[model samples]
Target: MNVNRRLNVSEVGDVTVVRFVDRRILDEANIQEMGQELFQLVEEQGKKQILLNFAGVEFLSSAALGKLITLDKRVKSHSGKLILSNIRPEIYEVFKITRLNTTLDIKDDEADALAAFAALQAT
Candidate 1:
């Protein structure tokens, strides 16, 4: 559950893109810590957009999903946007089954996600 083992992040324009490179996003207490770090980054940066690239993530837990919910709201409160990108099929299925696909913005790639965020900000 080492938070250090999971998340990786970088900036894309005004977007803070966090890539969860690990296979497991939950099943440990560190997920919460990772969530906290992401929360703080959004707050501190005044970031208007985010792209969560799940390309490397193979599995997700309810805890990780909860973190996503937290992040979604954090971005929303700032009038910012959060876009989930590169979701694998298995993980995407989980999101679909949980109906979270309705609550969050899912995209096929980084460019599409960033474009959607830009459009949201433009409005």
Candidate 2:
């Protein structure tokens, strides 16, 4: 897949780790591009396991959250898995408030997220 300016995509074994470079995903254009890139990775690149590393991200708009939900559904439909990691507590609290925390697979770090994917593979 092509490189995305908004996202830094990498591979860890069988898992594709996507890191968001933009701190605030609030704009429509950037959000759409981010979602499309993620979809392409799954549909074209056949990435079944994904880890979204939010180490530098500090803000996410509601629209951005919607994009994430859409991406999560796409991954699940393909029988794939998506895990989120390194989300700042404030940003994570948004998920909790929206009750998306229950639906999304969130972890504390990339290593933990990778481990979770490995555990899923073992099951």
Candidate 3:
């Protein structure tokens, strides 16, 4: 992984946590590429649920949002889910306005997000 890249990825149990540590998603030109990277990483690792932590992200473009939608679909196709965690109030409102929050599992915190995934996996 590129050191300067905004995303820091790791696995926690059956879930893969992709934390955005930077304020931005970095290169707009590589949004799709980055999205594919994330998808492939989870798929290759056989991770069912994913926690996309956006706590450090201050802004995200529509392109990034589109990529997230793509990722959500990919995860669901495998009978899994993508959960958005630690979304700031402002960014949460953006997702709300766009109605992505309704489609994606949007959690207020990491603990709740992980618990939700674990509970789902238990079923």
Best-performing candidate as measured by TM-score:
2
- The residue-by-residue lDDT of candidate 2 on 2-108, one tens digit each, is 87878899899999999997998898999999999989888888899999999999799999999899999999999999999999999999999999999999999
Task: Give the per-residue Cα lDDT of candidate 1 at 55.
Answer: 84
Residue pairs that clash (backbone atoms under 3 angstroms), model 3? none
RMSD of each: 3.1, 0.9, 2.3
For candidate 3, the TM-score is: 0.87
Supply every candidate's count of residue pairs whose N, Cα or C atoms clash at under 3 angstroms: 0, 0, 0
Q: Pull out the clashing pairs in model 1.
A: none
lDDT by residue for model 3 (99-118), tens: 98889889988899999988
**Ten residues in a row with the worst lDDT in model 1?**
1-10
Among these predicted structures, which one has the highest lDDT?
A: 2
TM-score of 1: 0.87
- Candidate 2 lDDT for residue 19: 96
Question: In angstroms, how far off is 80's CA in candidate 1?
Answer: 1.0
- Please report, in order, the local distance difference test score of every candidate based on alpha carbons: 0.82, 0.93, 0.80
The order of the candidates by TM-score, greatest first, is: 2, 1, 3
lDDT of 1 by residue, 5-35 (tens): 4568788777888887567777667787778
